[model samples]
Target chain A: MQAAADLGAAAPSRRTEILDGLKITLPFMVGAAPFGVIFGALATSQPLHLSPFETMALSLFVFSGSAQFVAIALMAVATPAWVIWLVTFILNLRHTLYAATLVGYVRHLSLGWRFILSAGLTDETFAAMEDRYRRLGVHRNSHWAYLASIIGMHVNWNCWTMIGIAVGMQMKGLDGLGLEFAAIATFIGMVVQKLRTAGAQTAAAVAGILAALLAALPYKAGLTIATLVAIAVAVIFERHLERRGQA
Target chain B: MSVGIVILGMALINLVLRCPLFLVANHIRIPGIIEKALAHCPVAVLTAIIVPFALHLDQAPDGSQWLNPDLFATIAAVAASLLTRNLMATIAIGLGVAVSLRYLAVF
Candidate 1:
């Protein structure tokens, strides 16, 4: 009777673990949908005259919000292809940092999962998975859950791009009732969640102010430089605290 | 210059940024340097994104072409974020304020 009770309790926990991971991880798909809509709308306005298919494809292939924004903004002005490429590369250079952080966690996964997961890597996905891994050391199935979240985000974002393009095409002009507000709202929600900690709050504020001040740098390179500067400042402060052994 | 060159250059740069840490993790021991560097990544990246857009804003009441949407929205976003501690609410309010100000001809 005791053995049966233990087995019954253990059975539910295994199911609960997977369920909990998916619950938090799945919302990113909804959160990411607005960006896709914005992208599709913007892409249609570009000189390239991208069809919905093309716009969706770009979302799937690039999958980087900042990079896609930079690409389309450059394309709008008929900027040289090489220059556009360079700008996108610089904007996305930070992904390497994420890739490095994740390596320690995903090192034991099969090569196939590694490649697929690598392709789906994004800031949000990495942070979500990192927090989980840091909390409860890596587990074999955790990668699967992480991958599920990534794939979920990828599909929703791309498919929503199609939806946005369709809406953008049909609507003459959305006045007052702005569906576009969804993305902004979503971003705010996510940002609020991230700001619960003092360190996170401080880091976000410093970075934002620095970025604003450096907005005019050539090639929009100021943005990238501002990020580096803020990071340097944050790191210095963190080191000071570490010296005191605070964190 | 050429498409191939552009692709190659971008790919190489991406590779350089992404893979170095993994290749060397087992090799040499570093003391908190990587962690510190990683810590900066988000702040650096976000700042790079926001600063230009924020500074370009010039919101003034006169039709004298003052007030930038980007800058105003950012200010509102930040203020809302800090005050409410609610990202979604802050962003919505910020965007709303910016667009409203734009429509009403107010900075």
Candidate 2:
């Protein structure tokens, strides 16, 4: 993973890291392709009846699948505009955590670069970029690689979404494909891979159980509550370890 | 039309939520204790998302939907994920199991 050394200055190895980023992101791009298409299809389908331009515009600007999906579902039921906005906000709280976790890695970056990276941070991009950072065991300035991954997905999402819109206009349905389950399984795989520590492992279990219990909470806020509870428990355990000089 | 405006609102609020942390990342310094928690953020957030939805309790005709296709497939996915450690493979396995079960008319 660490082919280039001497990060001497920001973006010096930009070309190489961008290529590395693209290569690392290839596998995820394949997995996400169908998801983008499905989203586009849903957007243009009868229930939502969104114009292709609206679908593309949302894809271009919003760039979040879950939020868009939730928004579409809400809008299909004629949910209030405020509720749609609120739901999208709650669904996106996880990005705040992604931002916090990336602080140590991107603190040295310029504001302009940070803006670009932040806009691009999603579940898949964060996973790919974070995997690379952990491997390098260094903190900052992989934005070139990070940038590559985000930009690649951005382009891919837009393209497939447009294609999906066209397909939706022609075809009737896609629900039977069980595509959403694939997304679920992907997250499960990511969670398993990152559960390296006992504390983290137990924290994940706590979060999962609590989230399942509170899944009926209004506006999907249970996710935020569950995430916060897990973080609190994990931090408490980490403090114990730190006190014992084992951290 | 009005829908366009609502979506614009979405884009605006979204960018506002997304931009600040990265923009201020250089200025703000997080303390050590919080950093430890942040390290586990991915696992927590991801698990929060997956578990509740994967085990969704929507009712069914023949008793609990716990016996439903999604949950049954998630069980298979979890087992496959633990063994494969590969995201793509896990997705394929889970989707395959769920689709197959659905085709067989399993709840």
Candidate 3:
């Protein structure tokens, strides 16, 4: 029973930890909010209609900005709803990688806990956690810290969506000032964080340029191809380096 | 038949592909090719996603346009991010550049 009390004390501390994590992650929302606002505004302009509730649900549940954008764009063209959803789903298939990484951290928790944590898993969260784990060896309690980071992010995202909806309703020019550039800033930060060696930076630059060359393919399939190619090239190079004891 | 199925199928395949990686983390000896691929996953994934958005904004001669708001904003944002490394400053500059250019009729 005393152990239970100790665990309870730890729980409140976890909440505090989560709060602190939010402070660290708040800037990510700067990018996220503009994406949401663009989504809300773009969806509003379309003839393919959704109730506000549906729009909210799409953002809340689907929770993918690019996929959501594509889905709405397709819907505006009278594409079947299933096709739009399917494409969005496929586009976001990468989230599974995020989920899988997180599973190792939280699979031992209760099913409900696992479900909740999995729902909150996202690219930023996954990257943040991956960087954390790589820097500090895995700990049993690391999931809690990662979860705290995500909780901070979750509040920022949802609240900003509400703000976007409000501003989208009343404003016309919010799309000005290139707020979407925030995503570029965010990506640069992510890339900088991921740079552990010269090889990684080379791989990133090659992939960035290659993906740009292939950006016009149908259904964005060109992107998938470019990514696979870049990965293949980098992997081969890294292995050669490793064999030479030069990595 | 529904797009949801596609979405769900993609999700399933992704999980299945990765499940082995996680479950076999200790048991299996991964091939060198796979190791190299894993090393580049961050770059590949980021490049794959960011590029399309960056180039989405382009201009048509007729006045109707697809402009690269992301690209323009990214340029400014990257500069700011590299300079300040302050999250707020980078995003603000990026967003400000994209939106201002957008509404200023600069195309």
Q: Which numbered prediction scores highest in TM-score against the true structure?
A: 2
lDDT of 1 at B77: 75
**Worst 10-residue stretch by lDDT in candidate 2 chain A?**
A1-10
Which order, best to worst by DockQ? 2, 3, 1
Expressed as tens digits, the lDDT of each residue in A1-247 for candidate 2 is 1222344444446688789889999887887787788778767775667889999999999988767765665566455576567656655766776787676677676788888888888788989988888886443346788999999988988999999999878745655545456556656777788788877897798888887776666655666688778879888887787779863
- lDDT winner: 2
Which 10 residues in a row give candidate 1 chain B its minimum summed lDDT?
A: B57-66
Model 2: share of real contacts kept: 0.62
DockQ of 1: 0.31
Q: Model 2 lDDT vs. the true structure?
A: 0.74
**Candidate 1 per-residue C-alpha lDDT over B33-76 given as tens digits, one digit per residue, 9 for 90 to 100:** 65656554544454444443344321221223324555566667
Task: List, residue by residue over A158-177, the lDDT tens digit for candidate 1.
Answer: 88888777866765354433
Better model by lDDT, 2 or 3?
Answer: 2
Best by the DockQ measure: 2
Name the candidate, 1 or 2, with the larger DockQ value.
Answer: 2
Ranking by TM-score: 2, 1, 3
